[model samples]
Target: MQRLVLRRKEFSLFQAFIYKNIGISLGDHKIYLVQARLAKRVKQLGLESFGEYYDFLVADRKGGELEYLSSLISTNVTSFFREHKQWEFLKSHLASILERSGGRLRIWSAACSSGEEPYSIAMFLAEHLPNMTQYDIKILATDVSPKVLKIAMSGMYSQKACMSLSDEYLRKYFSPVLVENEAYYQISDMLKKQIIFREFNLVTGDYDLFAQKAFDIIFCRNVMIYFDRPTQNKLVDRFHAILAKEGHLFIGSSEALTDMKKEFKSKSASIYQKA
Candidate 1:
């Protein structure tokens, strides 16, 4: 079978389609990258051309194919404790946030790929907060990819995946388990109970679903970089609306809220506090 080639016109069509639907801004230089990422999918679908794949994506009503396209195009590079500085800030200010909420806390790990970010939060809370069971704490971990969510829900990681974790954290929070004749570290049920993982697309997901929810800390790290200024501003506004007064927003170290006008004041590196 001949490999599908992404023609220039097909690239243009994809650039517009991805921008309109996924909110990712693709530059002229990204043509090769997009082709490289999408070639496999186009071939897997047995489509002769990228244009046919594009047509198939548009005609599919359930939107799963579009999601797969988004998954292929978007990056999901993540790990435990990705931003050290942000975690440090969270640790220092956690006492105040807890006091404000009177031991009740709500945290949302937006774009929590493969469960690392949310699980890291749970571990940090367990390690630092005394009488860990005393507080009414819940973490809402959401992602756009069902593929990553499945790995996250399972909480199983190989020794390679667990390498970055500290010995103390691994011993305290995870248990050794056998999976398919190999050893894997599994997150403890105690930690798992604190998190609720769900599938959510930040671009197209409805805000009305969270009408009654107010988050004290929202971690939307590393995702806005893919979006244009307009999309970024819109998302920041939505986050602000759902955040309680004096709540915090944690973005990726490389991303900034400077271009987007918002009420959040910069507290530290990539950390913002609602004022």
Candidate 2:
């Protein structure tokens, strides 16, 4: 990849541009990183400079170019059963949570990438909450990137994604399909029915968390690392507002709210309860 050395002013301009357009705040030090990630697109478009590419992103009216730009900027690294401790907590507390909320359950897998986390939740609920059949159990999965959301809605994955799941759960919850020497597991329709996928941008608008209803559990793990301190604070406050009384918020294992206002108190190492 060709290294495009961006000047400090140019970097700031690009950052402002993207923040205005897509709500991603790239710092000055990320110039090289941005170039590295986007160099291929620049070359493929036969652009002479990063500025030209930026202009195209802003001015492109076809919508495809803008979608491609958003796809490049968004981060989508995720795995099945990440942070197993949280899942353990969910399993332990499922009965109590359901009981406390009058047997109605709504979970928001915010920033769900390629459907792993939500599907894991569905599988867990399927295994543990047999009473879920009588109750309203729904998982709302949302992401900013439509591409990733489409993949997530498909609920198809390779064996690597299901490695953490047990054989019994795998056989019961998913069906295998052979495609070109590799097997892809498709989530059973029963489990898929419990999840609702949508496109959402956490930074730009007001989500429907504070409407008539609220989520019982909000699993927004590993998503806030992209925002600055102010953005993080705003997002956390929004989370606190939308979360039902006594609702739980699960964040990334390494992420904490030390820098932000303490609306949620730590219940466990990485879990916080809305206060």
Candidate 3:
């Protein structure tokens, strides 16, 4: 089998396709990256060139190939309790937030990769919220990749994935099991019961679905960094529209709102409150 080189023309086509469909902006330098990431998959599909792969992605009406492309182009490196500062901020403000909502707390873990972020929210609330049974708390965890969502729904993690977790949290929230001589931890039903996972494409998804739903906290961390400025601004606007008054928006530490910061007051580093 011959190695397929992704031509400049083919790269440009993909660049436009990804931006229009997925809201990610691929720079000129990323051509090599696209080739490196997708060439093997193209070969495995028995496609002769990157162009054919792109066509296959478009022609497949079910959008499964597009999902595969999304999984490849985006990085899903996540773990339990990522971005510690945001959690600390939530802890300090939890009481007031719950009070404002009258004990009905809704959190949206947008781009919840591999279930960790939403699960972390559940665990954090379970640990912090006093009289947790009295509160109607639910978390909606969404991501574009069904692959990761499947992992998330299972609520199982390998021993290596649970390294960052503390001893007490592990004992309280997870049950240990051996699968094929490998150690894994399953999330407790208490935590799983609080979350609902679904597939959503942030860029192309219908915002109308959330017209009636206003989230208290929207954790869209680390996702905006991949989008262009215009796409980022539009997404911020959509988030602003659906968030409750004075709701919080948590972004990745590496990302900033820039022009969109006017609509949201900065509470902490990469954390904003809807003004």
Among these predictions, the greatest lDDT belongs to: 3
Task: Give the per-residue lDDT digits (tens) of candidate 2, residues 15-46.
Answer: 88667666778877788887777778888999
TM-score of each prediction: 0.96, 0.91, 0.97
Alpha-carbon lDDT of model 3: 0.92
Candidate 3 residue pairs that clash? none
- Tens digits of lDDT, candidate 3, 1-275: 78789999999999999998888999999999999999989988999989999899889999888999888888888999989999999999999999988888889999998999999999999889768999888899999888888999999999889999999999999999999999999999989989999999999999999999889999999999899888998899999999999999999999999678867999999999999
Poorest lDDT segment (10 consecutive residues) of candidate 2: 1-10
Candidate 3 vs. true structure, TM-score = 0.97
Tens-digit lDDT string for candidate 1 (55-77): 99889999898878877887888
Model 2 residue 146 lDDT? 82
Please report the TM-score between candidate 1 and the true structure: 0.96
Worst 10 residues of 3 by lDDT: 255-264
**Candidate 1: 10-residue stretch with minimal lDDT:** 255-264
The alpha-carbon lDDT assigned to residue 264 of candidate 3 equals 94
Look at candidate 1 and tell me the lDDT of residue 66: 80
